[model samples]
Target: MFGPEGPSLRELAVQALSSVERGYDLLAPKFDRTPFRTPDSVLESVAKALAPLGPFADGLDLCCGTGAGAQVLTGLCRHSVTGVDFSAGMLDVARHRVRPTGGPEVAWVRGDARALPLRAAFDLVVSFGAFGHFLPRELPGLFTEVHSVLRPGGRFAFPVLAPPRPTRTGYWMLLGFDTVMRVRNALWRPPFVMYYRAFRLGTVLDELERAGFGVGLHALPEFGRRDDGSPRARLVVARRTQPAAGNVNS
Candidate 1:
């Protein structure tokens, strides 16, 4: 659901018809006002979870639309933070909106997340609400790029909600959404690739392990337990494990 300042149904329709990059560019101004942006509660939960792992010297936010996760980096990393996105418009909004109020300096870089420019350059990396744009096949390179950017022992973290059960209404909702996206991509010239069902946690953990991260999950207690008593959401913290030299002295 969107607020008064958010995009109207007509505006959302127009965005859905456009390519992912172009749609994000069009939506950048109202992104924070929409449901698409990561909520502050989730970000706060993540920041608290990551605090014990700090203090990092530098960090990067992969596919950082409006830099919500990147803002978390300012508190975790003591030195600098960089927010990168393929959409110039999104980066522009991030530059002005989430500029570091904490001690760490911030920079906005316009580039693709699949082929990040940095190498072993950051102490930490985080992303939020941007995974639906990438197909499952692209995750290998996406994880690799995140691994490449982080200093060994550095973390590549993000929140992943539990997949809905087969009988659940939410399951059908995602299944229907993915099916519609596939049909749209089949008929449309430039595809709109946001699909809720594409990113699976189990499959994702496998991909991340193959990409050289020692993966672990931390339960976000604030979201509470499901009916089965399993935590409904977790922060996937994948640490790059190369050698002690890549380790954080702090």
Candidate 2:
């Protein structure tokens, strides 16, 4: 669902046809008006969930489009917050939009998440609504990059919704969306890599473990629980374990 301030259908078509970076650049200004932006409710829920675990120092928001996660980090992190994304356009908007008052200083960096430009400088890292851009095979490398950026005992946290069951219309809708994306990639140049079903929680936990994070899940009570008593949404809190022999924090 998009508001009147959101991109036009024609504009969206142009974006969908472009490379992911260029597409986001074009959509950056109107992103918050669209459903693509992480919802404020979700952000608040995650902040509440992370508050007890933190009194964190420096924080990083990986793939921080428009700086929503960075805004959250300001409340929990004491020193500084850095938002890194590949799209310069998105970073531009974030720099202008997310100024905090009497809180952690915020900075924006333009870089790929696969190869971050910084050292292991962050005590907490958060990402929101950006993982679908990465394929399942890329999870190991992506998680490793996240691990590398975090200080020893630092956390990499993000929220994941419980997948809609087959009985729900949302399930078919996501299935159809992914199928369309697959078909488009097959026929189009410079594939747009958004898939709703690709990031499974079980697979992600295993990858986090292999990347040397001690993974845990915290239920977000705001979203309530499913009929089976499992959480409807959860925050994956992956803490980077101390480095092995010969591995340095820096």
Candidate 3:
């Protein structure tokens, strides 16, 4: 649900019909006000989870919309932090909104996630609420890019919630949303690739390992656990154990 300052119903409708880039551009000004933005609680939890891994020198926030993750990185990283996104409009807002208070120097860059623009330059990489934009097949390339940009032993971390069970209303809602998105993409051009159900945890872990990361899952105590006793949410902390041999570092 959106706040009063968030996008209107008409505005959301128009955005849904546009290309992903343009839609985000149109939504950028009010993005932080929307439910779409990563919540402060999630960000705080991630920062706490990643803190022990740091005092990292430099950090990159992949698909860093509105700079929420980048702000988290500033606290953990010591030198510099960069927030990259394909949307220049989002980058512009991030530039103005996420200033370095006492941590690393922060900067914003406009770039596609699939083809990021830096080499083995970062010690830590983080992303929040952006994976739904990528399809299953793109995971290899995406993880490869993240691997290439990270120094050996560096981490690529993000939070993942355990999917809701079939009996839960949340499960039905996500299924319905993905079903709608599939139908929309089947009919529309320049598909706005946002599907809540496509990013499976098992598949992602395999891909991360294949892309040369030594993957691990860290339980985030904030969200607690499900009835099954598995943590409700966890941080996937994939360490770049080796260089991505065949992958070009953008």
Candidate 4:
């Protein structure tokens, strides 16, 4: 649900009809007011989860819309933080909005996540609420790109919520949303790809492993647990196990 400052229904309709980059560009000004932006609670929880594992340098926020995740990196990473996104408009908003004081230097880069412009340049990489833009088929390459940018033993971290069960109304709600998106993409040109159900934990872990990450899951206690006593949200920490063949440390 969007607030009064968020995009209007007509504005949202226009964005849905455009390409993902163009849509986000159009929505950039009001993205933080909308539910689409990653929540502060989630960011705080992720930061808490990552703290013990870090003291990192040179962090990157993959698909960093408006730099929320990059703001988290400023606290954890010591040297610098870079936010890379395909949307110029989002980067512009981030440039003005996400200036953290007296910590790591923050920079913004415009680049596609699938083919990142940097190599072995980051000690950590974090992404928040951007994976839905990538289709399931693209996961392998996406993970590979993340791995390629991270230095040896560096982490690619993000929080993932446990999928809602069929009995929950939230389950139907997400299913409906994904169905509508699929239909929209089917009928529209320059398809806007977003599917709530597409990113499965098992499949994603496999892809992360295949891309040379030694993956681990950390339970986020802030979100509590499910009825089955499993964690409701988890931080997926995928560490790059080795350096690329010829990557010079940056």
Candidate 5:
């Protein structure tokens, strides 16, 4: 649900009808006011989980929209922090709004996650709340791109919540949202590709391994657990295993 300052129903409808990039462009100015932006609690939890593993030199925030996750990177990394997103409008909003407080020099790059422009660069990489835009079939290329940009022993980290049970209201909400998105994409050109259920952890872990990453999952205690005692949320840290061209330490 959106707030008083958030996009109206008509604005949301127009955005849904447009391409993902264009829709985000239209929505960028008010995105933080909407429920679509990653929450501060999640960002703080990730920053805490990453703290012991870091003191990193350079970091990247993949699919960085309004740069919330990039702000998290500034606290964790020491040298430079870069936020990359395909939406120029979103990057413009990010550039103007999120200010880093001296931990690192922050920069914004407009680019696709499937084909990143850099190579063997970052010591840590983080993404927040943007994976649903990529379909299941695109995972391999996307993961590979992340691996390519990270230096050897560098990490690719993101938070993933456990799927809601069928009996829960959240389950039906996600299901209905995905169904509507499917129908909308079927009838639209330059299809908007947001789907709630497309990114599965099992499949994603497999893809990360195939992309030369040694993956690990760290439970985030802040969100608590399910009835089965499984963690409610986790941070997936995928480390690049192959040796880099230079003997650079991460």
Candidate 6:
């Protein structure tokens, strides 16, 4: 699903061998041409869903690549928008892409997601197309980091697609991809951590709860429903817990 301007097969091979940051830096110029960038359609759907919740003061885009999610934050937030990622290359691209908007000021920080540097600073946090880089065991730490950055009553939002059922060919496709990734990582260096199957919804919700967020799912009916009428995708909204002593905002 790569565009004509995307990386060539040789470039892909070179990137696959380097570490994540360097690989992304080399790919930064061509990333949007690939299927990896979150589409504007998803961004529009999310913006519509979050708009009514509105008028947030600050927003954070976790693992924001090319600042696609940050653009959505511009609609929901009024004060400032920040995007943090460990990849310097990705951050560079993001900074450039969102530069001329001049509507909502943007900041790009280079840091690992597990130990984010902010403390209760953001009113809204969002991420897109980057979760697969994290392993299952890393979810708790990742969620904790996100929680630590959010102010009381602030939200962490992201979209999740429904898992494929046994009857679906998509199920087997994802299964095969994950299996190959496991095998590849077992033998490769500077392991690429993107896997289609590692982040299950139940486990993710449990981790968010443990990290002190009150969670809810907002079904995104745009993608339609399954045979049983379950939503094909949903936006997970987890609001940061206020102190047990009192309601900080009130």
Better of 3 and 6 by TM-score: 3
In the range 54-118, model 6's lDDT, one tens digit per residue, is 77999999998788998789878888999988888888888888873656678988888989977
Structural similarity to truth (TM-score) of each candidate: 0.93, 0.97, 0.97, 0.96, 0.96, 0.94
Which 10-residue span in candidate 1 carries the lowest summed lDDT?
Answer: 241-250
How many collisions between residues are there in candidate 1?
0
lDDT: which is higher, 1 or 4? 4
Comparing 1 and 5 on TM-score, the stronger one: 5
How would you encode candidate 5's per-residue C-alpha lDDT over 1-250 as one tens digit per residue? 7779999999998999999999999999999899999999999999999999977999999999999999888888889999999999899999988787756899999999999987778999999999999999999889888888888789999999999999999999999999999998888798999998999999999988888889999999999998999999999999999642232342
What is the C-alpha lDDT profile of model 3 across 1-250, one tens digit per residue?
A: 8889889999999899989999999999999999899889999999999998877999999999899899888888889999999998899899988987877888888899999988789999999999999999999999998998898789999999999999999999999999998999899988999999999999999999989899999999999999878999999999988667575442
Ranking by TM-score: 2, 3, 4, 5, 6, 1
| Candidate 4 local lDDT, 1-250, one digit each (tens) | 8788899999999999999999999999999899888889999999999999978989999999998999999999999999999999999999998896988999899999999998778999999999998888999889888988888889999999999999999999999999999898888899999988999999999988888889999999999999999999999999998543244442
| 5 versus 6: better TM-score goes to | 5
| lDDT on C-alpha atoms for all candidate structures | 0.87, 0.93, 0.91, 0.92, 0.92, 0.86
Which candidate, 2 or 5, has the higher lDDT? 2
Tens digits of per-residue lDDT for model 1, 162-202: 88899889899889988988998899869998899888889
Worst 10 residues of 4 by lDDT: 241-250
Off by over 4 Å in 6: 100-102, 243-250
Per-prediction RMSD in angstroms?
3.4, 1.5, 1.6, 2.1, 2.8, 2.7
Candidate 5 matches the true fold with a TM-score of 0.96
Q: Where does candidate 5 clash, by residue pair?
A: none
Clashing pairs counted in every model:
0, 0, 0, 0, 0, 0
